[model samples]
Target: MGDRQDAETFNNLLAAFGMARGKLQLPCVPALKARYVQKVIALANLLEKPLTSAQVEELETAIAQELAKGFQASQHSQLLISFQPNPKSVEQLDFKITCQIASLAEFYEAALKDNFATDSDQLDRLETSVFGKHANARVLDLLPELGDPETTTILDIGAGSGRNALPLARSGYAVDAIELADTFCQQLQQQAKTENLPLSIIQGNILDPLLRPKLNHYALAILSELLVHFRDADQARLALAKACDAVSKSGLVLFNIFLCRPDYQPTIADRQVAQVAQSFFLTPAELESVMDGLPLELVDRHSVFDYERDRLPSSAWPPSPWFINWATGRLLFDLEPPPISLQWLLCRRI
Candidate 1:
């Protein structure tokens, strides 16, 4: 079948690529298999029309395994690649990669361009407007309030599009922005280069072991609009612990949590829908419980909607009382309430 042929073809191509390097015993030239690798990838792409999603995943896995093998073999043959594997360390053991959203850059970019274009103001700004005013601007406001920008360093976990980081950098603050999306990282790098911003963009999971040594160096750490994406409280807690660990004592750590409406309760169907969406909302009390022992102290909490209402048009006034009463079901005896918008929590590393 095509799946079997896909695997065999990949292995054969890898072998040929390795052999093309003249037995792989001499000095390894850079990109020795670049041409053949491209060929293999093209063949895999060609199969896309016939392969199911599962089949495509299986094919990619086989290709990755074989590619890894080719690289490993080149070492034994004394033909080194252009790079070396990183040294493993204990910090890696502390943080386990529970989830890795694949093709995150592409997915996020598409979502931002399509789904959020009308619904989100964050995506509307100059493309580099990675951070919107409601949630992100509030987080950014603390930078000037903290002290001198020259003396400060900020670590922005999930620094999508450098929205917050770029502004901070322009203000003469040092920023270390970590993002998982490759496309976003590239965009950030391009923007930094174009604007000559003092932003260091790191493209990797924030919880990577290689980043542990650099964790505690920041004076300000921001996790803007990110926690809601986690599957549950425990996973969010681990991420928070890692963020706290990366900051010095008394360093400012800021993040936002999407709070469920006070009266909201989900039915079985509602929970199923949320699971499909991969979004989990937590109450303020639930968020506090998760941060119980972390080396952080709750400093400021703001309802971003209320805090930034001035930005809206006169026509965009607060929700009508009728709608609110209806949503809360004050007219009825009992029913679950709908979700409120966003809530932010600002904490300091204790």
Candidate 2:
């Protein structure tokens, strides 16, 4: 353990753990764990001396601790990974452990079958936990660019809490909001009444046939963060087509879509998250293909982050919620194998 080779071997093991750590989600954990085990063996072989049972236990426990930390961070999408090597931690490991180390794969497998309800209360709790009440300023900034605010008739599809709808209505534009969630629809209606804003709050699915006839002739159609809920690409395309049809000839439609990494396939955890959302993450090319034959033309494509960074509080630091988001965005920008990106697509009828 005195030689530089010993130190280097430990570093390699830690680095391999880091690599496998990234792939520790439900579907890929087994394969990734195999790679992690290989690294553990490589470290043992490098020592040349046979490790005592105590040493082996210590090493495995240390790795498990780090993996647990990673698992906790992964639960929050806003977290930025801070990967500082803790080589000294191995010295602190005690051989007092009697229980078998809990498997990361087991945790993920059980999570996949989690019985959390997707009811209104669950949705409300989930939304409250992950996001704040503030609407994205980028969506608001694009409103004026679409057309004049005074006379424009804006239809907000899936307008949760009237984030964009209420603001547009308050700005003197006529706004119609369609929300499927009963609680959200009621809240939006109550807010609009309090503000005395001109808003039409329809508590129903945006695709409902009865709602379609009433949604027509809008100057601007806002579909922000809604396309991801469609069952598939074909359905997304149909939804986009419907949004286009609802707008006037001169109107524009703005929506958001998530683009997956070109090289990396989604893991089971990724699919599970998408399934819960009723969404599919597509690559930019796949999204383009979905809209290929549609009459709608892409007017502009915006990076959601570009408009959001400045809005972050200046005091964010030490991994605050906003800091984590900023750090995650920065890391992904420079990440060797890109993950996924949330992008805004602005389109107009031909």
What range of 10 consecutive residues in model 1 has the weakest lDDT sum?
A: 90-99
* Candidate 1 Cα deviation (angstroms), residue 73: 32
Q: Give the per-residue lDDT of model 2 (tens digit) for 75-191.
A: 211112112223554322222211122232233223323532245455433323223345555566666666777777888887865657866888889888887765566667777
Model 1 misplacement above 4 A? 1-103, 112-135, 207-213, 275-278, 311-337
lDDT of 1 by residue, 1-350 (tens): 66777655776444333221111122111233344334433443443322335544544454444444543333112222221112342111111111112233555665567644654444435343333322355665676666788888888888876667887888888888888876568777877888898899988775455655266777888887566455467767877887888788888888766566667664433432332233345665777788898988888777655554544344433322232232232222134334634556778887
The local lDDT score (0 to 100) that residue 163 gets in candidate 2 is: 55
Q: Every model's Cα RMSD, please? A: 16.7, 12.0
What's model 2's lDDT at 127?
28
Stretches of model 2 off by over 4 angstroms after superposition: 1-133, 146-148, 213-216, 265-269, 277-279, 311-337
